[model samples]
Target: MTDETDVLEELASLPTLAHPTASPDGERIALYYDITGRNQLHVLDVESGSLTRWSDGEVPRAVKESPHWSADGERVYFHKDDDGDEQHDLHSITADGETEAVVTLDGQTTLFDVGDDGDTLAIGSTAAGQQNLYVHRRSTGETERITDHERAAHSGVLPPACDRVAYASNERDDSGNQDTYFVGVDGTDQRRLDVGEPGAETVPVDWGPDGRRLLLSDTSTGLNRCGVYDTTHDEVRWLGDGDSQERPVAFTPDGDRVLAVRTRAAADASVVYDLETGERRELGVPEGVSPFVRFGNPVLDDRRVLVLHTTPTRRLELLCYDLETDEYETLIEAEYGDLDPDRFRDAEFFTVESDGVAETPARAIDLSPATELDIECLLYDSGERPSPLIVNPHGGPPVQEKRSFDLYTQFLLTRGYSVLQMNYRGSAGRGRAFREELYGDWGGAEQADVARTAEHVIETRDWIDEDRIGVYGGSYGGYSAYWQLVQYPDLYDAGIAFVGVSDLADMYENTMPHFKTGLMERYLGTPDENPERYDARSPVTHAENLDAPLLIVHGVNDRRVPVSQARIMRDRLTELGYQPGEDGDFEYHELGAEGHGSSDIDQKKRTFRLLGEFLDRRLGRPVAASGRGDKQ
Candidate 1:
């Protein structure tokens, strides 16, 4: 039997490295490492395998974003936010640890691309009510706004010349459809590329090694397709069949091939596409292992690339891959102190069929039972028979559950709890139609698919305890927890929602402007435009129907979903005679210094403990009282 405390501590204490970028000469790498349990900028000498901390605790900010190397590779550019406020400010630090702020704009400012000349930076800021493009010159300390739009616009790669930029914008009449556009640095000659289908999203990926052709990633046809737009020819040459979701990682050093990852059912296969002969070569990665691509650059030396390798039973490890040899060496090994990797459970991927039929108070998505929708799920079953199950819906309608290590899931398994992660109808990684299916039917078909699939698992698998099932999630998943409890109250014994949306209409009003136009409006339109749908879908609207125990956790400084979501749920439950505190079933926790989620290690430990304690109390399976006194 596993010691619950030992499992939770080691898993929670697991160190993490993220946002890695290779230096220009490929001798060093810059990334954020949580070695001290607080994420900070660190530089790793590739040859010596020595790590050096660059950023001091001068400002005491969270460095959660990616770091980029300047053209000359003298300094690394990164973004930091106050606590978890999510208002990112750009900063640069030299190898010698000389740090300085590059640009501090209002609202959330993202450093998109550092130009080839190393002086100009392409950025997107929400300061203007919505996300817009900006060009900042590092030498002069001057900033120029390139585009003023009501919707969100994000920049792609900045070419060597830094004269023109490519970006994706949803400013079209149909806000759901996004297209790639090119504009000069002076904000002139702004023209749409006419690259994708009518409603598909075409986003710029990278410039070819020569900077003459732009690599474009298209999701307009459900599966991802690639296109090379030649500036001189003024034409796009499309690549790949519309089979699987293929994403362009980078161009080969010689510009003869494109490194792309084809994703099918959440599994990725890295392949190189020959531009001249249309030949495809697989990278021959081990089965069930996926390469983690950094936001911008993943390439290291001329033929080497950096990838974060992860498997279901393994934690994420940074690795350097040689394309020519198809071999990789672990740069930073994932450490799980005092824990055995063999104790970790592997995920069992399966699918459940649910008809696209749904019934809602305001709307019905489909009535035909003939149209069955497939919902994919990943289950990590505990060895114990009749295991208490936690149905965990992933956070995004756009983010699906991947075959990767999850400490929380592992912790739960050690406590004899089976975890079920679902990709209900409208989740990403399955293609565009699978994603868009949840649009306009937020709590409708998507919710149905999740509940039905959970039910299917409970019925088919005798190992899952139907009576002790719980629903848990963060963000959209958090919203699903509330919706599931209220909609199918008898199905769940308890539910936990983290930074989740409670009232759809209120979320639309209170969230960031970019979320309103780019995310919410794209799904349910404006609350004013579809008030009935919004009212019907919002969980707070159905708070009276909540019958099971609920634990609501939200970051007070959350800008994406807003803390008001948790407040609204708590207020409604209070009004419905559900008192909160240690004495009540409806519990609420407001993280003071956090935004969407927490970056503090102690806070994470506290959260896990709280969650475990709640599950123990609600499920009537309290931890065995060891010498540690009732196993806190």
Candidate 2:
């Protein structure tokens, strides 16, 4: 038996919930939980508040996704990938738990929207590395390819009572410009709508119940602005102020109003938008819960919306809202019964002070330069003063570290480490220019912002131990972890790079075919177009400057950031005379059966254990007699 005393083990053992959707009748919910070693379908009885396991017998753990109910309550729909290879197939489980295959394909296939009649599905796939949209007929098993664009198209949706499909696609233009395109069911007469001003790119969200008007989100400005595109007039009517993000949750049954989630800074509120009047009203937040709302979707009962209520101190739970009364009721159906919610504390956000300095020490947070842009930093202070500091940066430079429950933050906090999550220049939610700041300049400005953030805390706060600072991240963050060690090695004692990119040139050439379509071209531009920038930004380029110990982790099947990233870094460090192991300056670990850091309970638990061990051995150890902050 495992040692139950380990907080990380406990955190790992806790089951997580995802892809939740309420049944059409509002009487039940079909969601999947990853408790059976693999994700499986589960149903909840809304009336009796009882939960039932739908996919219990499957062994060897098949990862499932897109759990939703059919037009009628008798069937639940979902898709499963084969052993983390990206090959997906859609499956349906009847109310009696009888399973049937909807569509089985050899490549990446996702079931986006299921029609009210439960006979049609909107699917987007990269079957042969040609990302395109397809409309599927359930009864006849017929598939019609819609957009034959060479580039990638995504977010396909089918509105009710219509023979047309709407999706977002980038034809040839780079810079991540995805225009909303509509095509007929038979794959003809495709036309792009004039969504907004030339700068913003619009993506299809949903259609009004009548399918006459399409709901879209213009994300060209970084923050999303909700809009309604009237098919009759071929015009766009903006809904929310683009400053605060307001995304479509679901349209009311009557279709005259859209239930939208409006978020400004950290706080979020649900609002109802009247299409005809063009007015909006904010919904009340539940008492004792943080204003950070992760609303999933409104149930069949148009009067209520499903909200994911999570805090630093508690595990996530599903909550229902009464739009009329503004009351929130918790559903006890989630599988978080055995998990202790009190182990975590809600994280606090603060603005750090960035003052001037010519220079102090080389390779350290010597300057404390000012943040050219307004950014927010989230701190999970261990509650005790003078604790170890972990500067954990998030991935997807476009993704923001919002106020939500994170097990890793809680685990680190519980183990006497203070974590600082920085929303640097490249992070989203601050608008377009802020997010695109690192566009052409990939590894430069963000590095300075991160350095300043840490230095700012060290200067302003007395509780953070300046000598015991470390950094860790995965994906782009993994790249950052290595980058920080080599660029500013004097400031960090240790670092962990998990499935991160170290070479921009290699990623452009080696990443999966779908990623090469526009994602890479959008940010880094082609290495062919900008070889100097790619060479300059790569962490591997500056590997010889390392001053601190580093831990590198990767998955063998991570096609996104291939294992070669870790291998390259390892080879360079070895060439510099660094050994690998507990005593070496560099340590490496790879999960053989995992792909791109799968959220399998065991894989995550292993990662957390490995991370805790590394940090504890390095950061938890006492300083040397002359202590220069080396991992030894």
Candidate 3:
């Protein structure tokens, strides 16, 4: 008999690594480490090898995240939830380990910046159901609202100076598009920085050392690009100055140049741009990995740029880019080397005939070695016939699927299942035309693209069992899974959805107030503008068409998608005669304390175990004993 205790023990033994944050002075680094099942912040002195724990004697309900050092480096500020409600509050810990609450608002508080003098804190709060900027004075305990705009404000630090703040707000035009704005410490002299026009939104990613030059990431009309705006001259210069999408990672400490990550389909490379000469140099790294390699954000010192890079064989390792030599050096390697590049299979990219003009490009990574593929297949039989196949459609139906390293993908591969991840049309990384393919045709084009990708995989790969193929995803991906089971009842044999939206109308109405207005109108047409489109695409309207076995997982406190979505679907499935724990028809599980994403390790382990069991049962694979309690 399989022991449940053994499963729990195995789960407790998994290794976890948190992103490391460097102090302002760059002399100390603070990071959250999961030591034997608990996540805690640990500070290490660069010169002395001294380590200290900053978490004050409490088992936090959520993991400590976004740790930033105060201007003076005397204190460290972090976000955590102690009350189990999942609302994060900002807290500060002194160098000597004395901790105190900086601000405790009703909703989640994101600390944007601390003044250079360490007296004023710039924070973004969602207390009013939309994000608004605020400044909290430590000396007087006075909290003043900075931006009172009708739309949401995302706060960031201005370049060269820590006293001034830069944020993006949709105040000027209520069309619900954001524009970059700069404000002083006293919240006066707020002016719109002309990074882009009214409809073209600008996102401030990093500031130059002198505060006179700013690096901005712009995503207008579905294409991503990066540029540098000179605050003094009010001149904007595009990095790379071409058609490809780009992102600025950080500015050099001298403010003379900016480091950026440039990405295209199937290829990602990093480069540095010089402000004075308008010259760009490539920081050569391996291909096939994301360009956002840095742990916290890319940090610059006099000699080297500290970044985190991960190859197919590597998890995430810290590397140093030396400016003088234009070379790279490995600093820290990820512990999981056993499951490196050679162990897993690689995918191939091809052009698919779509919409009469080859409008979309397609890529497929084979989970196993095979030539002949199965079409309209729930499962395909290689030498390992009957082994389960999990088809994961990525979130952001507008986002393209890529050959990248994902933790969940690795975990499933270890469990002896072939996984197929598809990047359909409307996904980013592709050019503007391909990404906007689903703009007015979200459900129609995106859904058809996914179905086509599945058919292509089954027809080309002999390893996948056409009958045992299961669909799984979260958020938009989850919505796709639900839609697939309902719209094409005979396509997938089983389905798993996490925080999926059953009704587009309910999702738009109940989502966090800030994202509700703009995002809803963009993806799904407004309730009044395109009523037919909304009614036709929404999964809730086609619930009766569901024919496959389904398992729905949701966090009860999920404010983004809300638990009610899963609840409504569960109730409908039950009403349709699909019952839980009865030969895999329908089941729903809600984590009492989780929100949009699962943070607790045990809950994550549970989610994986349940998913594995469901797929195993439906696909006729031998279910391995649960790896829950097998800790060392």
Q: Could you tell which candidate, 1 or 3, scores higher by lDDT? A: 1
Using lDDT as the yardstick, the better of models 1 and 2 is: 1
Per-residue accuracy of model 2 over 1-632 as CA lDDT, tens digit each: 43434556667767777767787778777776776556667777777878788876441143435565677768877766655655567777886668888877656777777777678788877765666888889889987677788777787788786477898887635465778998887898898887754546688887887788888888765677888888999988888666577777667777878877676665456678877888888766542233322222355476766776655566667777777787877774334445555556677778643332212233422333434665688888876556778999888777777777787787777667788888777787666667667666667667766766888777778978888999989888888898788777778888999998888898888887667766677778888999988887788888887877789999887777788888988898888788889888889998887767766777878888888888878887333212333444
The C-alpha lDDT values of all candidates are 0.80, 0.73, 0.66
lDDT of 1: 0.80
Comparing candidate 2 with candidate 3, which one achieves the higher TM-score?
A: 2
A best-first ranking of the candidates according to their lDDT comes to: 1, 2, 3
lDDT of 1 by residue, 1-632 (tens): 35676666677777777778888778889887777777678889988999999877632344456788898989988877876778888888887778889889999988889898878899989877788999999889998898877889885568778998889997677767888888898899998887788788888888887879999888876787888899888888888767668888778667887878877766766777889998777775566556646475777766887777677898888887787888888899988778888989999998888875433221212233424777888988887665778999888768878888887888888777789988887787787877888777788778877777788888889977777889999999999998888877778888999999999988998898888898899899998899999998888887887877899999888889999999999999999898787658688999888888765666677789889888877765622322221211
* Model 3 per-residue lDDT tens digits across residues 1-632: 25443443344334455667667766667766555466667776655656577665443545634677777778778876743445678888775667888888877787876666678788888887777888888888777777776667885664445567788877653343568888876788888876665665687877776667777877664467778888889998776666666767777777777877776655567777877898887776666654534435455365566665654335555556677797776644455422334554444555443331111221111122111221111221222443456777778655555545555665565555666666566666664556555566656656655666676666777756676677889988988888777766666778889888887777877787666655676555577887877777777677877777788998887877888899888887777777787464787788776777664567767777777677666655523423221111
Best lDDT among the predictions, by candidate number: 1
TM-score of 3: 0.86
Clashing residue pair totals per candidate (backbone < 3 A): 1, 3, 39
Q: Candidate 1 — which pairs collide?
A: 200-220
In model 2, what is the error at residue 353, expressed in angstroms? 6.5
Regions of candidate 2 where Cα sits further than 4 Å from its true position: 1-5, 35-38, 57-65, 172-174, 220-222, 241-243, 287-297, 333-343, 353-371, 621-632
Question: Mind sharing the TM-score for model 1?
Answer: 0.95
